[model samples]
Target: MATINVRRDVKDSFYRYKMPRLLSKVEGKGNGIKTVVPNMTEIARALSRPPSYPTKYFGCELGAQVKCDDKNERYIVNGEHDAERLQTILDGFISKFVLCASCRNPETDIIIKNDDILMDCKACGAQNMADMRHKLSTYIVKNPPAQASKNQRKQRKAATAQTNELGGGFENEEGGSDDDIISQRINKEAAGLSMESKLAQEDWSEDTSEAAVAQRMRELSVKGVAAFAEDDDEGGESKYELFGAWLDEQDNNTISDDDIIAKAEELDVYGKYKACQVLVQCIFDESIAAQIPKRANLLRKFVTEEKHQKAALGGLERLVGLEYKDALMKKVPGILMKLYDVEIIEDDVFIKWGEKPSKKYVAKDVSKAVKKAAQPFLEWIENASEEEDSD
Candidate 1:
């Protein structure tokens, strides 16, 4: 069995055109017991989203069981007979038909078989298949079914395999055909590139100059970066465009370095939440934290993102914990007081480092710099506790 990700555009086409046609065929030809095909739209939708998201692909029991589509008809279980046609159907899907990302092939005859972890590949008769996994993940990434490479298409159309000068003969390596070897190599290269893309693009070399950052900061400060709250649309992207105009004001050296920080300050206030996020993110490239606000205006957005927010807080704590420990501790109470009064959804969101709470502790320690903005948050947590426990 194989799984492939269809490009979003290809997916849209299938939903808008191909799938409807397939559905029509099914509807028109139904006699008594309808042999219904799985809804490609439902499959595509499930596969397109993130894993933890609601209504996403939990897993597929498809291709694992050899069963008939007709629920009414008493169909005989015929895994072997269906395998070839199912493979052909899935091949058609990878060609133009939209397919699910989780083991898409209809020919797949895998079974749970009492919680067995190992998937013994019925097609190649291989166990513990790393190569097969690579093939599946690679197919899922490519999405919109691509034209078979020119060389591959030629090989497929070829009647017989003949030896080439470079030892890529028709008979190729042990057991597999030349086409199979080519496909494997192509898959390997594609997988490597895919991995490279997924990695966060951070350039944290100590030697890199902060010139670009300073210049951009100057632009943002002057033009004023936009900062729209997530809940507040203000007709979308109002924050980023203002900052972009500021960036456009400078070409190479149109702005002077002496006033760059000043310019960045001006841009900081009006930037969009999304743009502001990027501006703060730019510190990874430009370590000149002095170019931006001493106060973390950017920290407001940290509450929304689960992973990045944790990274942001932990990194800041590690940084400030060592450098300005005495000053941070002095200001901690005030900050927590302020934070407690603010609209934080979770009380523990303001928790700081160096303090260990009980294993089942809920709210953060109240007297911290982070909580100075809202001290009432602690009281709110206590009040909410009763409601939560009752539920």
Candidate 2:
């Protein structure tokens, strides 16, 4: 994960929302979150850009520019300092001189003077740039980009495999994107169009062709999804305005049946595993299966999946059978037990080195992921509670 760099708009945007995400990976997930308070001098250097220096200055003097010195200047981004905010800001970056691996604390007494890096840690005193460089470089080298992911791993493997690979992106087949068009043309001819498209061929537009079809139901009403989904199971019709609002059906809150089938066929674009939860949840009626593709058709035709298997089954849990229920339920118990009803845990938390323990009960962020994953089950339990009350 690349660290988030300086971006002013940190309001409701991703910077604020995903900060905890980044924080969790480094501190929350990795080795129980080693919180290194960034050395203050490095923090200041990072938040405020380093003063630009001349080109030749790079060999001997450029080092001085980034290092804390009379010339290096303490961080006063837009002219103020709140060390915590500065910390959150730096969470967005991958590489910069501001990062120090030996010491993670931002408030470290180590500040670079004109000729050297001086440490406040009792064991290490002042050290020259060459020494700091050697130490920091070793750590950086060992760190393996600090944010390796599956994509990065694959790219790394591919890079090593081929000598002709350029700039470390993926190797590709020659025909470019047009190959997709040719393949699709053959697929369309090979697989005949169903009644829905044959009937509504004139109404369909070319604009949303590239739009991901699986997510269409999330935008539509359940009733609409079902009506469009069921071929033989039809009565009421839907005024489906492709990218439109939830249909206004006067009789019921549940969406119309037509939209369900339309949305179900849309499921064909993605793999079954990826589409199942969303497709299951968005389905309003089962009768529309006659018109929809395979899984949606299966759902439309069968509704007796009645083993109370709806536990974490998205919205359409009532219709999906025991096999799905058994598989899904097994995974939920441990996650629920791990995160649910747990107010606090006694793992080490980062407070200022000498700043005394904060009330341990107050830091709720440590358990956020477990709580987030637990949300649907929590809602299910609440709904069950309501039903029990009504009973």
**Reference-based TM-score of each model:** 0.24, 0.20
Number of the top candidate by lDDT? 1
Assess each prediction's global lDDT (C-alpha) against the native: 0.33, 0.30
Alpha carbon lDDT at 30, candidate 2: 25
Total clashes in model 2, counting residue pairs 3 or more apart in sequence or in different chains: 41
| Best model number under TM-score | 1
What TM-score number comes out for model 1?
0.24
Per-residue alpha-carbon lDDT of candidate 2 for residues 1-391, written as tens digits (9 for 90 to 100): 1234233332313221121122111112222222222133332333322222111112132132122222322211222223344344344331223223342212123344554544332111223232445334333233312233467446534533332222223323321122333444444554565655676767655445446454564446444544454322242223222212222122223444445544434432122222333334333233312213323223322221221112113322222222233433334433332322221111111111112322221233322322344456556545544555566
